[model samples]
Target: MKRLLNAIRDQFELTHNEAKSALLFFVIILVNLLLYYSYSAYTVNEQSEILIEDYGKTEIPESEERKSNWVDYGSSYKKSAKKVERFSFDPNVATNEQFERLGFPKYLAKTIINYRSKGGKFKYKEDLLKIYSMKPELYADIENLVSLPSKLDKKTPDFDEHRVIAEEKPAFAPKKTFTISKFDINTADTTQLMQIKGIGKVFASRIIKYRDILGGFHSIDQVGETYGLDPTVLPELKKYAVLNTKVKKIRINDLENFRHPYLRYNQVKVIVAYRKQHGNFRNTEDLKQIKILDEATISKIEPYLEF
Candidate 1:
């Protein structure tokens, strides 16, 4: 012990008294820690014994209320084994009920049905793995059961020709015709817009939303600016939708907060700050004074602003 203290003193460049004091302090801490842990272990063991004794003696009475309230977590966690029917069936033609009979969960079966309803096809057995919820283990088990073609003949030289001919033949079938009528773009609601040939629920909703953001459409061409508007549908849309209503304009001086499809956030901030620093904009000429507002930008928004 004396040699260990001498070594520590020499190694740390400490005096005899400092090294002795440190050693004593360390010993005291070690003793305290051991005592603390020993007491904790004894306390824990005593509590455990008490719990065990109480559990052996305790009697829980059976009652309907208790039974109803009590939950068996062990049983809840255990999955009920589904009866899997191993049978060959075409994935593209299989119904939801048939998928369920083949051990697929109801939700996954519905997913397959929805994919088919949206014109998705399974041309190969490997395509079954394309489903997000399809487990590799589950697919491995049923891989032989998929009745799709082994592989697509992608290398066929005349495949494109045959496909084009098949598509062109469908053109000869008499197409169901519907009459399209003209309606005011600004005043027309979603139901009225959906009545047009090309516009559906999604596009109709987007048109109304964009119009609301812009305070209303100023011209028929502005409807074409809607996000994801199909170019082919524009002629049909223009044929039925007319911009006859006057657009609501934003007052330059009284504008507190503005939202426009054309104006970005920072550009708007600069415009508002310019108004505060200089004066309210008189016309498009005053807006051109701000370097950020270029000629084309000012021209685009000129119709929507009022002095």
Candidate 2:
């Protein structure tokens, strides 16, 4: 033990007294660790034995044991028929009361009504599935009961409404008018964007897609930058478009790859390499140090980069 302590003192560049103290401390810690593990193992085994003995002594009542094994298999094991009743009704024209009478929940019935109030129509039986919170089991129960065609005619935009019996068909109510005079371009969804006269589903989706890629629009002119958007639609878009949200900026020091629409692959590589060599960029002026990044390129991408 003396020889070992002397060797440790030399190896660790420590005095003999310091080495002895360290050795003593290490021995004490090792003893404590061993004792802790032994105590834990003994306590766990004792608890396990106590649990097993207690469980063996305890007895479950026969009623509860039988109930535990009972699994409800659809409507067979149920005490009564499902509260939901089946009925023939038009989802588009069905009143809230009619939906409730068919055993639909109040919230679900309200959602169906709200969907139609927003110009949503159930053209086919499958379209009912599009309604929010509509369950497959509920739809399956009423599959043959809806007063609409199972499938739409491929060639026609509108399906024939007379497919169901004349008396069974529900009278069509006038659709509620929905209009948006103005909305923030940064926050408007595809639904709101499509309300514009010239902006259809494609343009609406493209604008949103580009906006996401750009980290939200900073200017109204940015909306025009969206690919395939018609120039004629710019007038109408500018009239209603507002940009209230701040643009999401990228951290120049932390980013492994630049994902902005304005920055090219080569530019991103150069910027990352420069940051590695020179450290974090302080501002756009430091970015201008890269010869490849001209004034125009730096100016365009400057707003998106954070120091």
Candidate 3:
């Protein structure tokens, strides 16, 4: 050891005290490096232990955590939720409290109460199915308990058989025969026309008003042309009513001709222009020359026009 120290001192060109001081300084640096390495390893191990402990506290398996959360949620829900009760009820007349007691939800109970308050009636037990919010399972459960009538009962007369027979027996059974008398359409008054089976007061008045407008009826079919007259009653009217051919006529030159129902404004204008350009209308056929008048119209107005 002395020889090695002497060789080092000679190589470095140092005396004993200077070499000793340099050796001491080298030993101090080596001790500091060892101490630094030891501190670094200890610090890394301690950090790893701290990280593992923190992860163990904060992180959990997803499935196990979810299960725990669901248990707590269910307990909370049970405490907060309303308890449903089941009972018989008539939906049409049942109060809101009764509806809820019969296991109906709050919203559904309010809807039913509002419906009943608005004059809505559930005529039959099956009508409860009309509620859109009604659940099939819920309806099925209480369907039998709904005390509503399913259908209207047939009405029966409460007449005593012997009394009805005694009262209904007439002096004699009348013979059944049918005969209808014909009448003139032109001259028949309202009361006389109403005697017909189908002609009521309104129809009789309409017939008279139309006849007056036309001056008189040229054919029994003209009665069918009366406004508001039922077409179904036309055949009956034709069977009982006859028109007199002797009817009043309006001259084509007269301004009163415009009042004719068959002559519209355009047709009246055409007729007046044509008559001014030409002479008076010689016959009903002369009306066909007017472009506004069609063949059907000429035929319809022919009976009412007397040259």
Per-residue CA lDDT of model 2 for 1-307, tens digit only, reads: 9998867665553556778998999999999999999999999999999999878676666797789976443332122234556778999899998886776666678899999998989978999898866767767767788998876545654436545444766778899896667899989999889877667777788899998999988888878887656566688888888878888999989988867788888889999999999999988999889998899988878777778
Clashes of 3: 0
Residue lDDT tens for model 3, 68-101: 7553433333343356566667787789788766
| Candidate 1 stretches greater than 4 Å from native | 1-177
Model 2: worst 10 consecutive residues (lDDT sum): 72-81
Tens digits of per-residue lDDT, candidate 1, 31-68, equal 99999999999999999999998786777789999999
The backbone clash count of each candidate, in order, is: 0, 0, 0
Q: Tell me the TM-score of each prediction against the true structure.
A: 0.42, 0.42, 0.40
- Cα lDDT listed for each candidate: 0.79, 0.80, 0.72
Comparison by TM-score, 1 against 3, better one:
1
RMSD of every prediction: 28.7, 28.0, 44.2
Worst 10 residues of 3 by lDDT: 71-80
Error of 1 at 153 (Å): 58
Would you give me the overall lDDT of model 2?
0.80
